[model samples]
Target: MDVAEAMTLLLSPQGRLDPYPAYERLRAHGPVVEAWPGLHVATGYAVIDEVLRDPRYVVSYEPLPQTTVAGWAESPAVASIARSMLRANPPDHGRMRQIVAGAFTPRRVAALREVVTAQAAALVAAMAERGRDGTTVDVLDAFAYPLPIGVICALLGVPEADRSAFRTWTADLTVVLEPEISEAELAVADRGAVALRDYFRDLVEARRRTPADDLTTALVQAHDAEVGRLDAEELLANLVVLLVAGFETTTNLLGNGLVVLLGHPAHAAALRDNPDLAGAYVEELLRIDSPVQVTSRISSVPVAPGGVPVPAGGEVLLLLGAGNRDPERFADPTRFDPTRPQNQPLSFGGGPHYCLGAALARLEARIAFPLLLRALPDLALAGEPRHRARLTLRGYATLPVTTVTRPHQATGVEPRRTVATTSAERRRIARVSAGERGTPTGAGPGTP
Candidate 1:
């Protein structure tokens, strides 16, 4: 396919379901191909990596008045996402990142290992209980969705009862992150943004009155500190950014990881046999099937990536999903190998834009996956998995899985096993197990 056809396919629901072939076609055309005037697509591993790290490349841009809607431009969702560090550049981005980082310290994230393990185990046990009823459990809801959301809510000092509401708000608000979305969707996102902002405003005030040992309280204190701190808008925007970024990608990672493991029994067995390999397995999963598929950067000045000149203000779409699977960067790029050596997938954008929550995401996946496997050894697919029709942030909409409970041996303990059996059983299982179904299942080097 030509660049135009390829770009069209890449954005379609079917394309989002399996964009690897299109990526390969694009990579064959060149590392950097112009998709349209002033818009270039980067598919090569080295090129995407370089573009992300290049100082001249930026995330912020000034929208032309002709292209923007007057009132829509000022919408809460648009304003918050646009002003947040995720979309900012230079001094502003650095300042916002620094202040947020002060509270999101490594020590603080590292301290959540026990919490992640317990939460993962509890969720998996709950799934196991559902399996006992002979009912298929939606893994996305029962396990993948709750784990990261729970952890992030706990970190932010959000009450458990309020988390479900946040989940709905985040789901609606996340559509704003996509480059292509409907006006109707934008309206929903705007409402979610306003609700989130108002909710956090009250939360921040409460924290200020009574500081607590949580990131939200710490951020509130930083905002109210003597000097060089966040303004009210910046504080609220970053908190929203943190809440969404913290869980959305990690949720995808958990869902995609399970799909991959269940599809490859050998790999699943390996992980079950050596739970310590969870770290390596998580890395490979990230490399093979990244949660965030694409990120863009704008050229601040004339610059060349892959020896092709991009003029000042040109936009380059970094096809991170393609970069992770670039043949030159990975051996047998299409294959999922948990034990692959020296894996360095750019699932997380490189340099200053590298995901701030990388460590926490890794911690969640590492602790959760092993606990999940150990808890539900007989896990198998129950129905066809559904993919969310999102090209930028790829993940399952629903993953129906069942845990086959085997008869206990004389020791009153059931041995670990997989559940693929007869033609009917296999058919039912095959309907949802990654490769067996039409769903795209994989991720890149880190939990995005």
Candidate 2:
């Protein structure tokens, strides 16, 4: 199938698990192609980077029917949540991004280094224990999904006790990030919205009463006389955005990173030997696998960049993962080499609205992955790992795996039982290695 057709098929439930080959085809067809009416797809590296840096291109949904009509009409609750920099265009985007940036300064993220590392260690320990019974574990549910939620909760001053329920709220609000949806999905979206608003309202009230040092309180208090203070609606919206963006995107990164590591044992061994390499490998993983697979933008005026005209009000979908792997930009685009120096991957995006949480996401991955591989060097997918149902937000629903060493052994204590495997199991692993695979299952990473 052609790139457009393959993209359509990949968006279907059947192809979500693996859409990489489709992305390759799209990249080959041209740097830019039309996915559908009012929607153009850009797969080339320079084009994708340009789209992000271009001041004319807007991120606001106000111009698109997706946000103005279907998005808000179906779920009225999104009005407040979607007003932040994430969904805003230029001046509005600039203003909101500035305020949010103050709260998420690189200095602040740097302070989180030790805390993130500790969290990684603890979660890896828990995962190792959970697999003690010789039962397989889904990395998504067990570790990758929870790490960022917990970290963000800690940063936002949301009590650790509420992490689980708060995670559900994050999940519900991000459903729109999926490829396509039906009217019934809107109802579900409503429940998610209501739950999210209520949770944030209560949390906001608590923060207001006792002005703590969390991001929410910081935003509420920063500037003269709360100049940038968000009302209850705006507060909830921004919180939902932070939670959803920080939570899912990092999870996809960790998940996709693990898939890459497991698929390439040499890299895995290298990581096992030099945990410090994780600092650089995380970017390459994100570059090669590109956790955030696709980015959608709208053209404001008639502009031609790649022999393709994007008229006013037209939509463009930048296949960032494809761009990162474009052979025109990177030699050996298919290989997952962590040592590449020119790793200028657009995984965290480019330009003004680039991911505010990029630093935090990288910190989480760098701390989490090496710790995980060290604890369970023998970790491999247990069942036929499957991707989630959604398309817009790429990631796996399940990644069942059996750790090599027992919990005790993994923790550097004495082994309670020998890590066992048979010749047949080795052959099965080899078969999996040799099989012809398409794209990865799940949203193609970088989903939030």
Best by TM-score: 1
Runs with alpha carbons beyond 4 Å of true place in candidate 2? 1-7, 61-74, 222-224, 227-229, 404-409, 412-448
CA error at residue 197 for candidate 2, angstroms:
1.1
For 1-448, candidate 2 gives per-residue lDDT tens digits of 6766867765766655566677776766789987777778888989888888887787754622463335455474455346655777766655555545543545556655665665566566667777777778888877887677766665566665666776565566666655566656655676777887688778777866876545656545532245554444555677777777877888888987898899889999899889889888998888887667777777878876587998887878887777888898888998888988778888888887678888778878888788788888878888776776655566777788887466556665333322221233222322221121211111111112
Number of clashes in every candidate structure? 10, 14
The per-model lDDT (C-alpha) reads 0.75, 0.68
State, as a TM-score between 0 and 1, how close model 1 is to the true structure.
0.88
| Candidate 2 RMSD computed on C-alpha atoms after optimal superposition onto the true structure | 10.5
Q: Report per-prediction Cα RMSD to one decimal.
A: 9.8, 10.5
lDDT of 1 at 311: 94
Model 1: weakest 10-residue lDDT segment is: 439-448
